[model samples]
Target: MSYLRFDKTLLTNLEESLTREVLRTNRSGAYHCSTIVDCNTRKYHGLLVIPVPELDDENHVLLSSLDETVIQHGAEFNLGLHKYHGDNFSPRGHKYIREFECEKVPTTLYRVGGVVLKKEKVFVHHENRILIRYTLVDAHSETILRLRPYLAFRSVRQYTHENAQASRHYDEVENGIKTCMYPGYPELYMQFSKENTFHFQPDWYRGIEYPKEQERGYDFNEDLYVPGYFEFNIKKGESVTFAGGISAIDTASLNDLFTYEVEKRIPRDSFKNCLINTAHQFLNKQGEESYILAGYPWFKCRARDMFISLPGLTLAIGEVEKFEVVMQTAVKAVYAFMNGETTDLKVYEMEHPDVLMWAVWTVQQYAKMVSREAAKEKYGQLLKDIMTYLADGKHPNLQVHDNGLVYANGREKAITWMNSTVNGRPVVARTGYIVEFNSLWYNALRFVADLFVEDGEFSFRLNQIADKTAVSFIDTFLNEYGYLLDFVDGNMMDWSVRPNMIFAAAFDYSPLDAKQKKGVVDIVTKELLTPKGIRSLSPKSGGYNPNYVGPQIQRDYAYHQGTAWPWLEGFYLEAYLRIYKRSAISFVERQMISYEDQMTCHCVGSIPELFDGNPPFQGRGAVSFAMNVAEILRTLNLLAKYDNQ
Candidate 1:
């Protein structure tokens, strides 16, 4: 269950990261652009991919575009970009972004496509057909590439009710969408393109055939529309620039978000790799080091991203250079926090803010996987600095808990990465205190404590803190159902089974006995496991549903609850190996190591956002994600090498 170090393959990717173009995929299913600046030529080159939905409805194509900048109610005052007279969707103020409504058709919506970032922020200044550039971290020595995707919609209408009439008259037009240049970075110019061929979907549910691309040809949810595609041009080798579709805006308001991507994200180029060449048109970016927590496009920032992805992506692939870059990034983020920008309460978020205990724990695990005594020493200091920060109490009036869990926030709400919103309000605030963060805290301290117990500045106090936390965790978080509550309070707020416990089992630092660990694993496996991976919740839960693909609004209702997610599979498999004490993996492990190859067959390589809750179902994908591939590779390491190790 320990994190695995990177290998030659990962090192190759790391070297590539220095000169690689970006393959960016938003939540919506579209390839906005694939951009690269040839190192020899210094020409910014890019390919924008727009996957035609095989759905009979042509408008389904635009589903991706609308999702990227779909308009929402009342948001007009803030993030929405205004179109024509008064409509708006903007990327600014939309990081922690979730969904957007389909205008012509109420049933449809768009989501960003996938997860993966290989290079730093490479901005483009594009006007007319001529493209210019901004800033980039590596173009000086290595080639740089950046890409963005968009899906056009053709099917604009959907059933108002589950079994209602599918017939509705609607018009598709370019409402107010926002586009712009990176502020102060004149090399990058941005603009939104209105599709001339928007209406391509049938009025009703129909399937599609993709003769142009043989690898793809299928229908997910009969009701679909022509998807939109985002086009971006980066003049070769400039400075760093960022751009993305925004949701919610007015002409003036929407226009304001032109600087959304560039202004918000920090430039980063920690690592790289390119084993993956294509994604279900929606997702084509390869797996590298990625942070999928707080923002839509991370122009260039590191912290939670530096930590969360360290194990599965970085270490497993042996991206030592990236290892150093992310370590530096994490340290810088901690410094930024101490200097006053990051909030202790908000730092763990993948998109923004302070640092996360989970990240700290991940670093500890990553250190073990990396296994170099010197690297361990260097990161040991980094971990020690983090503990010092925790002891300093990272926020206004915040202090360490009795158990050494950092005082996350004083507010009773405001969840971190697992954040969910209903009607634009954080539904799970998860403030005041939390279980998983502390579990990570305890494990991280233990891992670090064990690292240099007899060496310099060792926190033997860390062990005492972890002990107290372990007792508190067992006494407080256990539920009557014999399963770990998703989280805890005076009364368990979530009775649903979840994969969060894998962190404990994987780390083996939590004071869990064989029984407790097995109990946690068993409960989750029995309650949340599906053929694909772990479900966010048990099917018996109220929100559980087997259907995975659908229109935007309805999809959210049951999403994560019963949807079979592949990202959690690696953790689950590792937990299985750890629990069963499998010294030598079986043939099953060998076959499953081909998880990516198998998953690619679905909707054909689009590793969906999640699979349907039911069996005998496939291709219900609304989004293509990167974590699944990364996790698969992680699992592959376990079977092909790590288990043997």
Candidate 2:
């Protein structure tokens, strides 16, 4: 569990939701620097900002509200700022960003009536069952301008360890504290409070105001990862929900919000070990299942995300209870998807074809993983029905194409993730023959095949599903040159070398031998490899573009052409693990070119959402995605165990 910031109503990354981020991506000209640092306070894993507001300097104010920001963190940022950057620059003399190792936990805020409450979770050690739930009350506000707040907190840990020092100096400092030049105009800032609250500071006090410039003792709003509390402001009689990443001092939670931190120490599963312990840190923290597919950066809820991320986020890592909760939430979506309640079905979501496929896969996978027999029976049977619906092509007015892929709002695009678009045309969603879709299909077929494998149990139906897949993979997908086509019936540029081919056999479905697998790997490795991770396509493709740092529209148009997605890094790693089951070490060497190169040289540990499509690749887009990080870590764990002599 890297780090998550959530409230009862909304959940998002704690570091991400800070109001200061608005400055980083600001259309105005405000710079932001945020980091997860030790209480001792020096910047480590420093995520600097080369703020590029979406607006072209119509207004220039960082502290005011505008959403334009340019986030450059870790190695990706280092390269972009140092080598490839244009006007975007980090401070002139500060050392470049590097990934620092610090075990942080999920942070949360909740609104309970007028009192907005908060919870901070910390896992000092993964194997340990100890989970510290630090609860506090967020300050409220009448107006952000005039507000003062107070808070109190106590740490109740039986086990103790010293926190690394992170006092920050604009340059460097011993306690991690550096007096700001005392005079400079930067968008974000930090400082220490002069007053006392209940004899000591609160366990956690966020929601500080970001000044238009740095004030000596102040740094970034998210700099401190400590368990102590700080105070801001609260409106006297105004209502508060008890959760907020930042506050203008609307309402205050007095003694009610303050309490000794409680360690809801649950027993760790002695049964299995891997990244499970870390996964549990995020997944097991109260109500994690309900929030799945809910938002991006952890936003944007979808049926596909809940199930696709179920094992890694909820099940394999967290408690069994979360599995049930997520399964419950997802099963409804599965049925809805099978019945054609796509993202477009709701007024909020425009429809798409991927939901059905993702739901079908999730329902079955959930059924398979659930330890309960009754749930297995019910969901398994439901899976069969869903699979049958997919087999027969069951949308009412919608016709399934010859190759079993669902089309967008009647003849439009939109099948898989990468469902973003520009000027009404789908961006990177290679509809007809997406690699992962067929990979997922192959998995479903094999899942059924395994279920009835005893005496060729599912042999008839299994063989049929397998045969259909084989036909589709060979006849529909395989282009004359033998390379799998990227899409079935799109524009003329369907043969662009992309990561889609890896999915054909990554699961149990493909009839892929070493030769076919070798071809797919070769195409992707040569064309897709960038310093950050896997590029979306061959740089040589006509539609390809590598510069992902810019306005959303431009980014979307060039989105998949050459953007290096860390998510694809997982699939590529998975394919390597599957194909070279024996040559694990060698495959790992090839699979992790970016991580090895970038993590140490660029963004050390934290994986950025994407890299610029071109050379001197810089991380761009959302700072991180759970699936991406979890999968990369999973890949590393795979290498660790398999490579063990």
Model 1 residue 545 lDDT?
69
Worst ten in a row by lDDT for model 1:
101-110
Cα deviation in Å at residue 134, candidate 2? 14
**What are the runs in model 1 whose C-alpha is more than 4 Å off?**
1-46, 49-306, 342-355, 395-399, 403-414, 428-433, 455-458, 546-551, 587-594, 597-606, 616-624, 642-645
What is the C-alpha lDDT profile of model 1 across 1-645, one tens digit per residue?
A: 101112223222323311222334432323232211211100111222222234431111222222222222212112111111121223322332232111110111112222111122212212111111222222212221222222222322321112233222233324312321112211112233222222223332222211111112222222223222332322333332223322222323322333453353322211112223221111112122222222111212234533554565555666555556545545655666656675432224332323456556666656666664755667666677667666566544335677554445523434454444557654444543455665667777777777767754556677777777777777666666665655554443665566666656655576677777778878777777666767766777766766644444455555555767776777677767777766437733643543433321322222444676677534343323445545665666676564556
Give the top-scoring candidate (TM-score): 2
Deviation of model 2 at 591, angstroms: 4.7
lDDT for predicted candidate 2 compared with the true structure: 0.42
The TM-score values for the models, in the order shown, are 0.55, 0.57
> On a 0 to 100 scale, what is the lDDT of residue 237 in model 2?
38
- Candidate 2 lDDT over residue span 1-645, tens digit each: 222222312112223222112101111111222332111111111122222123221112221111101111211111111111232222211121122221232233333223333323322221211121222343333222111111111011111122333222232121111122112223122122212121122222233222211211334232122222223233433322221111121123321221211233222222122134323322321122343532112233445544555555554343457766656655655566566555322111213445555555554544444543544465666656655665565744233455544333423565566666877877764654555656666666666555545536443665566666666666666666556777665553367877777766455456566778767776777788665678887877778887774556777766677888766766676676776776756756565554543332122223455778787786665443445555565466556667774
Query: Total clashing residue pairs per candidate?
Result: 124, 70
lDDT of each: 0.42, 0.42
